[model samples]
Target: MEKHLNIPISADEIRDLKVGESVLLSGIMITGRDAVHKWIHDTFIDKTKPATQEDLDTLSQLKPILDGGLIYHCGPVVSGLETKQYRFVAAGPTTSIREEPYQGDVIHFLNLRGVIGKGGMGPKTLKACHDAPAVYFHAIGGAAALIAESVTEVIGVHKLEFGIPEAIWVIKVKDLPVIVTMDSHNASLHTSVRDQSKSILNRLIEG
Candidate 1:
């Protein structure tokens, strides 16, 4: 099934999604990468150390936007940095598996309804989706420029000290295309593919 979803997607909406379904997402989304994920996990989820005032302030700002919303695993190529007028030049999805260690905790902490990225995540994140009633939306790899066209506005950014690619960029999108690779029911296309490949390899070895 193909569906169009707005930001702050409800738990019900996320639960309705299934693996292999197509989704066109509109409204707000935040870009998060390695640094952002680590920060979120350490500061909010694990509490490995105390959160500084700046960390608390950043969390306060993100909580409202992330609650029941989507997080895109992107490291966008940006322009106009000198003028402080940022624009996404190539907003491509990054390798999501790199975030496996932190994604599950971050999702639960933020009340995220969905995640957008290329290359699906792992079992931990799949379990988190089941618990949180969220879904993982797979964006097309190597279509950075085309995807950027869907971004309607750059709302703002936070934690720029993490560097441009790792900063949390709040953006508004219109009809950003993706596929449901992982869903709230604990279904995962990535797991299916991996298992199928393993089975095929086993058969070949046996024969």
Candidate 2:
């Protein structure tokens, strides 16, 4: 069945998704990469003067922008800097496994319901998805320009100090295609494929 998921999707909606299911997502999603993730993790971890309240307040303000929000692992090529108007030229998924160390904590802290990225995350993120009622959507690789077509507008940005590629870009999308590779129910198509492939290889070796 085809599912069209709206941004800020409710926990119930996410929980209902199954691995290998295709979804056309619309609404707002934030783009973040390695630097952004690290910054978020570092900012929240500083016990001495950690500005957690400030960060939480920022997310609070953004919550309405996307209720069941999605975080995208991407570094987009943006144009129109002279006019201070940003246009997405290309936006593609980054390797999700690179953020595995901090993804779980970020998802929990930010109350994010979905993640769009390439490759699959590890046990920590998988466990976090189940506990936080979140899911992982795998975007098509080598489809940067194609994916950018879905980005209707750039709403806002955070942490520009990290540079454009690493900054958190708030973008509105329409009918962006993705696959539910990992679901809130702790089901993972990535893991299933890997295990199945391994088993097949073992059988061939034995034969």
Candidate 3:
């Protein structure tokens, strides 16, 4: 049977999803890369000073904005020239494995229910998926031009001082398309691929 999920999904939710299936996502996804994660961990979610409503809202909108939303893990290109917009605009998915170390925490920190990126996340994040039942989805890589069009709005930004790659951009999107590679119920193509490869290796060694 098909299962429906709520915002800030747990690992349990992801486990049930199948490869190449569709899901309706809702809620916030905080954008970050290596330096950004370090900045956020050092400055926000892990801080002693509590984040104010504005502090949180500056870069994040609540459920109405994200209710049935999906987050794309992308670092975009900056026009870098003097123009109306002097920051990054066109974005492409980053190698998600780079985020394995912090993906789960970021998900939990933002109360995010869905994650979209390339190459997939690792164990901690996979475990987080299991715990939250949130599915990690994937989209065709190198398709940013088509992808950015999906962004309905640039609601706000956080830590703009971090500049470019390290800043958090909160984007609103609709009718985005992606494949379900990782589901909250504890299934993963990464694991299935590894398991099959290992079996082949075992057979080779036995022969």
Candidate 4:
């Protein structure tokens, strides 16, 4: 049976998932990448410099959007600039490793349940998935248009000053295909794959 995940997913839902399960996601997902991740971390978590009340307000506004939602690591190609009726030309997963340092903290802070991206994350994220009751979904890389076809609408956006790609994009989608690479139980298909590859390489070298 094909698994389908909906937005505002619960901890129980995340816990039910297992690594390597194919899932089709329905409902809303927010697009964000390196900059968005860093901004959230720096503004809220790090506090190297005290954030202004304005910054705090901005974060507050975004919090509800993120709670129990999915974050997509993607920078989409968009059309309809002049008409202001935007359409996704190409939307594919970005390399998720770049957000590794921030993802766990973001998920915990925002109560995020799912993340969609290309390359899998590491120990930190696996631990966070277990801790936060979340999962990481691996969308197929390089199938931009195919993936975009599933997106039903561009609901809204934020941080447009960061430019289109870097800005946070809210999109509605139906049955967007992904694989559960990391699950709420702290299992990681990515780690397994990497370990197996290393073992194979070592054996070949010894021969």
Q: Give the alpha-carbon lDDT of every model.
A: 0.91, 0.87, 0.64, 0.89
TM-score, every prediction: 0.96, 0.89, 0.71, 0.95
Q: Write the per-residue lDDT of candidate 4 for residues 1-207, one digit (tens) a residue.
A: 779878879889889999989999999878999988988898788866678887787777767777999899999998886786888889999999999999999899899997999889988988999999999999999999999999999887778777888888889999999999999988898899999999999999997
Residue-by-residue lDDT tens digits, candidate 2, 1-207: 779988878989988998989999998888988987787778764433366675777656665664568889999999986776999999989999999999998888878897899998888999999999899999998799999999999988877778888988999999998999999888888888899999999999998
Clashing pairs in 4: none
| Per-residue accuracy of model 1 over 1-207 as CA lDDT, tens digit each | 569998989988988888999999999889998999998888778899689999999889989999999899998988888987888899979999999999988888889997899899999999999999899999999899999999878889898999999999999999999999999998999999999999999999998
- Which regions of candidate 3 are displaced past 4 Å? 1-16, 23-30, 45-70, 78-89, 198-207
Prediction 1 global C-alpha lDDT: 0.91
Off by over 4 Å in 1: none
lDDT of 1 at 111: 91
Best by lDDT: 1
Give lDDT for model 3: 0.64
lDDT for each residue of candidate 3 in 147-170, tens digit (9 for 90 to 100)? 666555565566667766556677
TM-score leader: 1
Q: Ten consecutive residues with minimal summed lDDT in candidate 4?
A: 47-56
User: Candidate 1: deviation at residue 134, Å?
Assistant: 0.4
